[model samples]
Target: MKNYRLERLSSQPIIQTADVQPFIEGYDVLGAFNPAACQFGDEILLLLRVAEAPKAEKGYIAIPIIEEQDGVPTLVVKKFKEPDGDYDPRVVTIDGKVYLTSISYLRIARSRDGVNFTIDAKPFLFPTRMDESYGVEDARITYLDGKYWITYTAVSEHGPGVGLAVTTDFVSVERVGMVLPPPNKDVALFPEKINGNYVLLHRPMVSDIGKPSVWLAESEDGIHWGNHRFLFGGRGLVDTKFEWEGGKIGAGPEPILTDEGWLVCYHGADPTHAYSLALALLDKNDPSIILDRSEAPLLTPELPWEREGFFPNVVFSNGWVRRPDGTIWVYYGAADSGVGLAKLIQE
Candidate 1:
C-alpha cells in the first residue's frame, strides 16, 4: 500500500478566543477547534465547535449552566469552589457529577482553496434547548438527498448525547431533536441508505465497565435507530497489541463511498490519552462487515502546535472534503485549541 502525502496548512489557530470575545462575555476564553466540513457552492464550509469558559481564578472555577426562559435558552454562570471540584482543563468533576469547564457553540467558516478560511463572527448554532444547555460540539455534516444533515454532540447536565439538525442553505436550520441517548457520541451518518435503511456509526462510552468502540445501527427514517451491532471493537485477542487505538476509538467524518468499499477515517487514542487518526474500509453492501483497516495511525501529534495547548497531544477531526482531482483535504483540531489542515493525495 502506498502512503498519502500529508501537508500542514497553518501553524497558528485559525479561530481564537479573541475572535469570539465580542459575541460572548469579555471574561470568556475561546478554544475554537474540531470543525465539520462540506462543499457548498464554490466554497468549503466548516462548522466549528467553539468552546468558551470564564476566566479562571485560583480558588474557584466558573461553569456555564443552561436554563429555558420563555422558550429561549439562557446561560447562567455558576462558580464551583476549587476544593469541591477536580479540574483537568476540559472537564470538572465534583461529587460524582461531571461538568465541562467550557460551554460550546457551533460557528461557521468558509474557504475557497480549502486552506485559507474566513470564520463568521456570529455563531451558527447555540444552546437553545435544555438538552444542549452545555452546548453543541464536534459536528459531523453529511449532505444527502439535497439537504445537509448535521449530527453533533449535545452536552448537558444529564450527559453527552447525539443531536441532529438539517439545513439546505445554511442560513436557516431545522432542529431534529436528540437521536441517540446520553453516554454516546462520535456519530457519523452514511450519505446514502444501505438496503433501504440508513446506517450510522457511533461510540457509546460506559466509563470503566466497557471499552469505548465504534458501533453500527440502522434506521428507516434516520431518527429512530435499531438493529444495533458491534462493528469495530479496538480490544480483543487479535487487537490486544495495538495500543494506539486500544484505549478508545470513534468514527470521524462521513464515510466516503468508493469503488473499494466505504472509506472511513477514524480517531483513536492510547491509554495515555494520545490521539491519532487511522483508516478503515467496510463492505459497501454491508457496512457492518469490515474489509480492511490500518494497523497504525495515518496521522498523529508531530508538531509543536499539535502537542501543546488546552488538550495536549490531540489531533482530532470531524470533517473532511474530497476534491474533484482526488485530493482529500482533512481539517482537524490540534491540541483542542486551534484548527489545522492536511491534504492527502493518493500516490
Candidate 2:
C-alpha cells in the first residue's frame, strides 16, 4: 500500500525563541524544541526542549545543547571569556587552548490549555556525567500499560547517543544509561509489549557503508534491549540502484494501535537531506510488515516561521498527545530554533 504526506495540519506553530536562555550569563536566545506531552487529570503537560547560547565567542560562534539538571533537562549555558582575549571553549578547545564557556541546559514547562505554557526558572536536566557534558536533545515520550518512557539524544565529546528515562510524574525521572551508541539517534518505542516484550524503532546510519534506515529491537524490559535487527530499507527511483526511501526514515511518535494497524509517524529525507514527516502502518502482531505507508510527506516546512529559524527547513518531533475529541496535538522542533506544535486528524 502507498500513502502520502499531510501538508496542511489544523494547528500551526505558535512559539519560537522569543528571548535568550535566562540561566546562562549573557544568554538571550531561547526556545523549546522536541516537546513531550502527557495528559494529567484534566490538563495537558509538556516537556519542551529549551535551547540557549552563552556569551558570544571571541569570533562570535556558538553551539546548541540541552543541559541536564538535578535529573531532568533545561536550558542553562556557560559564558566564555579568555583573559588573553582568546576565544577558547572547553567543549571544543581549538587553536591549541582550552577555556570555559557558557553551557546549555533543558528545563520543564507546563500547560493547562496546551497552547499557553509556563516554564520553570531553573533547568530540569543539568550537566551530569562526562558522557553528557554537551547536553540533551530530541526526546520521544511513550506511555505504556503503567509507565511513561522517554527516549532522547544525549550528546558530548564522546558523540551523540540515545538515552532513556522513565517517570510517573513529570518531576522525578529515573535515568537509564545510553541505549544506542554514537552515530545513532531517532528513537521511538511502542506503547505496550508485543508477545510480552518491548518494541523499539530507531535509525542507525553510516556515511559510507550502511544506508540510514529504520531498525527494530525488542526488550523484555524497557531498560535493557537486544535482538537488534533492520526492519526497513530505502529504495531508489527508476534507473537508480538505491532504495526509494531517499536518504532514510525513522519511527515517528509512539506507535498507536488502531483497527487499521500499528500506525507510526516517521521522518524521511531526500538525498540532499531535506527532512519531512511521513506515516506507516504495520501489522499488529507482526509489526515488520508495512501494511499501509506514506508515499509522500505528512508535514513539511511551508510557513514563514517554519521556513526561517535557527536551522532552516526542518520539522522533527518525538512526542504528541491525543485529546478526547481525537485531535492530535503534535509537539515538535521547527527549524531547529525552538519547539512548536501542529494539529493532526487521522481521516
Candidate 3:
C-alpha cells in the first residue's frame, strides 16, 4: 500500500452548488456531486448527480411533485407542510409515507486535465417514468462493446433500483429499463465480458435479513442478470470488523484491471454514518474470490469540505479513470455537496 500515493487535487470543491440551476423553479439548493468518470476521445467525462431542494420554511419541508401522465410520471417542484413525522436532510416521513427532501438528476461535465471540469447547463438524465419519479442518481459508466453502459440508481414510490442506459454519443441516450429490482443499487458493469458473460457488482439492501453488502451477478446480454453471489462487506464478516466499515459498504468505481487482479475501490460507513474509502483485490478469473483487502481505509474525511455539507463526513465515489502512465484519478463527492478529485500514482 505504501507504493500508492494519494494527492488531493484542490482545497476547494471542484463542482459547487452554485454552478447548476435547478430544473424546477423555487428550489433553493443545487447539490451537484457523486460523478461517474470515464475517458471519451482524449477527454475526461463525468456524469454528475445533481440534487435540488427547497429551503425548509418554519415547520415545513418541500417535497417534489410526482406528476403522472398516461401512466408515465415526472418530478416537479412542490411543497407540503411538515406533518407529524420524522424529517431529515435526505428524506421525510409523514403519515407513514416517505418523501425525498430533494429531487436528483444526472448532468454532464467534461475536462481535459481531470481536475478542471466544465459542467453543462442542462441536465443529461431526468425522471421521465413512474419508476424514477423521485429521480435518477449516482451513475457508473463503463465503456463496453463500443458503447458506454450507464448503470444508475432510480428512486420512486416503488423503491430504489438499478436502471440501465446506453450511449455512443452523449448527445442521445437509449434507456435499457430497470435491470435490477427495488432495494438494490450501486451497480457497476465490467468493461468487457467475463467468460462469455457480462459481470455486474451491486449492493442489495435486505434490512430484515441482513445489512447491505456487495454482490455479483451474471448476465448473458447485459440486460437480464442472475446467478447472484455474495462478494463482501456485511455484519459478522471478518473483513468488515474495521470500525469505519462495520455498518455498511458498497462498490465504488468500476474495478480496475491490473496484472495482479481486479482492483476495486469501495465506500464504507460505520454505525455513526461516517463514510470512508477502502480497497480490495479480486481474482481476475473468478471475481467472486477475494484476493486482498485493506485493513484500514484508503481515504477518510479529514478536510473541512469532506466533513460538512448535505451529508456530513462522507466521501463517496462512483467513478475513476486510470491514465496510461499508471496514474489513477478518482472523482468523488465530498460531504455530498461537491465533487473532488484525488490522484493515486503507483510507486
Candidate 1 lDDT at 13 equals 59
Strongest candidate by TM-score: 3
Cα lDDT of model 2 by residue, 101-178, tens digit: 334455666777777777777766655655566767667778886767888777776667888878777678888778
Per-residue CA lDDT of candidate 1, range 144-230, in tens?
888999999998988899999999999999999999999899999999999999999999987757788899999989999999998
Prediction-by-prediction clash tally: 0, 40, 0
Worst window of 10 by summed lDDT in candidate 1: 1-10
Output the better candidate (2/3) by lDDT.
Answer: 3
lDDT of 3 by residue, 1-347 (tens): 44554577787888887777776666765588899999999889999999977766887767884678666675565666766655466777767878888888899999887877888878888878778888899999999999999999999887999999999999899999999999899998988888999998999988777788999999999999999999987443454458788888999878889998898888898888998887888899899999888777778898998998888999899999988687898888998889888887666
Q: How far is candidate 1 from the true structure (C-alpha RMSD, Å)?
A: 2.2
**C-alpha lDDT score of every prediction, in listed order:** 0.85, 0.68, 0.85
Model 2 spans > 4 angstroms off? 1-12, 19-21, 60-105, 236-245
Model 2's lDDT to the true fold? 0.68
